[model samples]
Target: MPKTTETTLEINLSALTHNYSYLKSKLESNTNFLAVVKAFAYGSDSVAVAKHLEALGVDYFAVAYTSEGFVLREAGIKTPILVLHPQPTNFKTLIDHCLEPSIYSFKVLDEFISTASHCKQQDYPIHLKFNTGLNRLGFRASDCNNIVEKLKATAAVKAKSIFSHLAASEDLNEKEFTLHQISTFRAVAKNLESLIGYKPWLHMCNTSGVIHYPEAHFDMVRCGIGLYGFGNSANEDQNLNPVASLKSVISQIHKIKPNETVGYNRAFMAEGHQKTATIPIGHADGISRQYGNKQGFVFIKGLKAPIIGNVCMDMIMVDVTNIECSEGDEVIIFDGIHKASTLAESANTISYEILTAISQRVKRKFLK
Candidate 1:
């Protein structure tokens, strides 16, 4: 493969397919798989990623906002898209685009009911989100009666699914808590069904939830990080291939004498003579400032180069003194060899943040 002169995010579609297959294999044949393509397909390419997954026959697609679904719909993507956080104001647009909204609260439910009715639409498929334990979104279990009342009052909207988020599905320590959440979600789903005279598709498992709680795989499973190559567990991570690789070229190299400083605010003061390589990527490109000043390292010639000084808007300097590297040499910020999970750990974050933080300004190269 030829090295690119600029920083690029390389997305491997084959690896993504492999991950999809692996995760799908974990599910029962009747269970539907929803590929979470929000946040630009976790900062890769939403159109590209969703298109490939669509081709693979994913049962559903999810995005954080309606605009994301709009992009896919415009691109001729025929898959059903679930808008996780649908604002009341975008109800009309969502309806027009054939996008389903996850109605998590009574206010949203009532508002959407009114909107759908005013639009004279009937049986518009809407998902009901219950707040079992995540508490971040979704209606409370106590709000189930009110939800049923509102839906019964309006024929404009129909419940398509009842789902909730798992707070810590990846942590073994939270196994008890996860089970409790599942139980609570099940009760909520049952209560809503009895009140409404029907049971919607019940889903509560995310990527880790699907891996750790196989029994919780209800009607469908929503997979986000796992599709882009992360399993949230050592054993599962080994089974999945990371789909994205961040690479750049060393633009310049400098030899700094003792006491010389580098980068903004002179954050890095050399103790002895040192060599550094500056790459054209920084916080603006999704490499957070927290990874600067010895906090993180990049791979050069299969060697580790610690980052030195502050990470600038478009530049980052790394200590490459011990490494046999020169300008124009390819550098790996995070790839299969230099896992994003490791880089994220150094920044006290998760791989999802690292992957999604990659800015849209950086060119994305897709490999099939």
Candidate 2:
């Protein structure tokens, strides 16, 4: 990869391939792999990532919304796409696109069945989302009989998979709660299978569960962050690589004398002579106001330059006083080596927020 001359998000397909293989290695030979490519593939180019993963033989793809799946379909993604959350309004559009929906509630399930029936569809695949412990969008484990009853009354929909989300599969401290969730999911799958008279794909593990709990991998595992990097633990993180790196170039350099203030609100007043670099990325570009006033740093010429003052909407001033860098020099916002997790930590957040928060306007460059 060449040095970035402007604000760019580099998506490394090779890194994605490696991450995918690493995650797949933890699963059984017959287990399915569902790649979660929502939120613009965690703010990298979704089409590019999905196309590459499709070539790598991912069993399925999961997106948060129907529109995301539509985008994938537009990109010619042929593998099955599971829309994790589908609104009643998009049920028609979802059916038109042949995207499967996760039937979480009786309302959503009923609406989808009606939509599918009205569309004259038969046995349209839909995943059953059970609320084991996430307490988010899912049907209760006790709702198994209701789901069975609903399925029996309709040929418009079919339960292709039964799944749930692990609230804290990455946190070992929540092992007991996680275990309970797993058991509940298992019981639901068993009861549902008995009632439905057939087996649907059973999955509960997310990225962290793939790393921490292989026994819960079940029939399929949905991996999101781990596929992009950061394994939710220091030990596991060492094994995966981040697929995206946000880079920019210094737009200008400023030489400030003692007592000179910089940026909005005079938030940073130089105590001594300082040199600052204004990079073309800020709150609007996903650098966020939270990472201002020396709370964050970017790597320039392989040296750390702390952000000096308030983060502007379109730019930020970093104290590059000691660095021997010039205008157009490459600036590393966060890369595999620097790690978005570290920058996110400095901002009192996590890797997911920073990674997915990246602005879509940033020009994407891919490393094949």
Q: What digit string (tens of lDDT, one per residue) describes model 1 on residues 1-368? A: 87778999999999999999999999999999999999999989999999899999999999999999999999999999999999998999999999999998778888998889999999999999888888799888888887888888888999999999999999999999999999999999998899999879989899999999999999999999999899998788899999999999999999999999999999999999999999999999999999999998899999999999999999999999999888999999999768999998997988999899999999999888
Global Cα lDDT for candidate 1 = 0.93
Tell me the RMSD of model 2 versus the true structure: 0.9
What C-alpha root-mean-square deviation, in Å, does candidate 1 show against the real structure?
0.8
Query: Each prediction's Cα lDDT score?
Result: 0.93, 0.92
Model 2 regions lying over 4 Å from their true place: none
lDDT of 2 at 134: 85
Clashes per model (N, Cα, C within 3 A) = 0, 0
Model 1 alpha-carbon miss at residue 132, Å: 0.7
TM-score of each: 0.99, 0.98
Worst 10 residues of 1 by lDDT: 144-153
